[model samples]
Target: MPKLRLKESLAGLKKIKININFKKKEKQMPIPPPPPKPIPRGLKIIEKYPLYEPFSHVVIVQNPKTGEHQYILDELQLDPLERGVYDRILEILLAEIESPKEEILDPRKFFAESAKKIVDKYRISLGWLPDVSWYKILYHAERDLVGFGKIDPLMRDPNIEDISCDGVNKPVYVWHRNYESIETNLQFPADEILDNTVVKL
Candidate 1:
């Protein structure tokens, strides 16, 4: 009788194990849906201005509904000295433009010409120029000063309606036209630097 009872207990345990296995199979999560593809929109290239060099450009685009957008394609990263040179030239140009004058020169022409002249004069005065591309330096200076500073490209993006950053070392977030709110690649790693950049806008 005891052996028969033991056999019945073992059989009950086996049935419980089978029931748990079936429950586990029933509890799997459903597969998530795939992300949406980029929507096709008719875009017109209105104008393209060179940014830091020939490698990258600041493009002005018009959409089908007659909306303008700005895009920076393949940005040119600059060294510290080159950055300083750009800032210096921008300051000088802004001061010159602000000075009381009968007529204000077109920013596009003024910046392009000023950059060429300033860079040449600077190199001659220093007696030694860095192993850097002068045209690139001038191009960036003109764009930042005459057009838009650090956030010029971001501001021009019609897709991005609002821009915000939480803190230093944090990626800036934008309200993208397609993606909604998303983090951007742009960051100002330091608070002071971020403050200065915002001041420009």
Candidate 2:
């Protein structure tokens, strides 16, 4: 009877050892690393300026996750006649201002002062209440005088390596920081506009 009891005890011990080994094997199995995270493509507005009242604007945008700048061309939505009038007004302003007689010491201050004078002149001489705000006037005039006008913001973006346009009614292309090359929403509707933009560049 004692011998039978010993044999039964040995069988129970073997069962316990087998269970422990199984648990050890399960723990030793390798676990996979989590899948790589996806890159974000959404853009956010970093800054903005009103270009024309109720219609056009200039905005500085960036990819929120990547911190990459994206150039935007916000155009005025107007009838051909109204747009023509505005263009003529802009041309007149540019012509009257003339080029600086000497090397400007402080371009920003000079442009700001000049823009204010121009706006004041329009109000007093022409009895014109420019539809745009004073700030908008300053932005446009300064861009034309000291910067590249419509393409100034694009030129200022460090992330854009190159800019190109195929022709009229085609979207402008830009070599972006993260996106490589991509088509921008901005487009030139006419050959003259494209030529003008190229001249500014």
For model 1 the local lDDT of residue 47 reads 55
Per residue, candidate 1 scores C-alpha lDDT tens digits across 48-98 of 544222334344445658464433244555667666666665565555443
Cα-based lDDT at residue 9, candidate 2: 11
lDDT of 2 by residue, 1-201 (tens): 011000011111110000011111111112222222222247776665443323344455777676666546564333454444445556666666554656665655665666567656665443444444333444555555565444555554555577776666766667766556665666666555455445433
Question: What's the residue-level lDDT of 176 in candidate 1?
Answer: 56
What's model 1's lDDT at 108? 52
For the record, the alpha-carbon RMSD of candidate 1 to the native fold, in angstroms, is 27.6
**Per-model C-alpha lDDT, please?**
0.47, 0.48
- Estimate the overall C-alpha local distance difference test score of candidate 2: 0.48
Model 2, runs deviating above 4 Å: 1-91, 105-109, 125-132, 144-146
Model 2 collision count: 0
Task: Give candidate 1 regions above 4 Å deviation.
Answer: 1-74, 79-108, 127-132, 143-148
Error of 1 at 58 (Å): 11
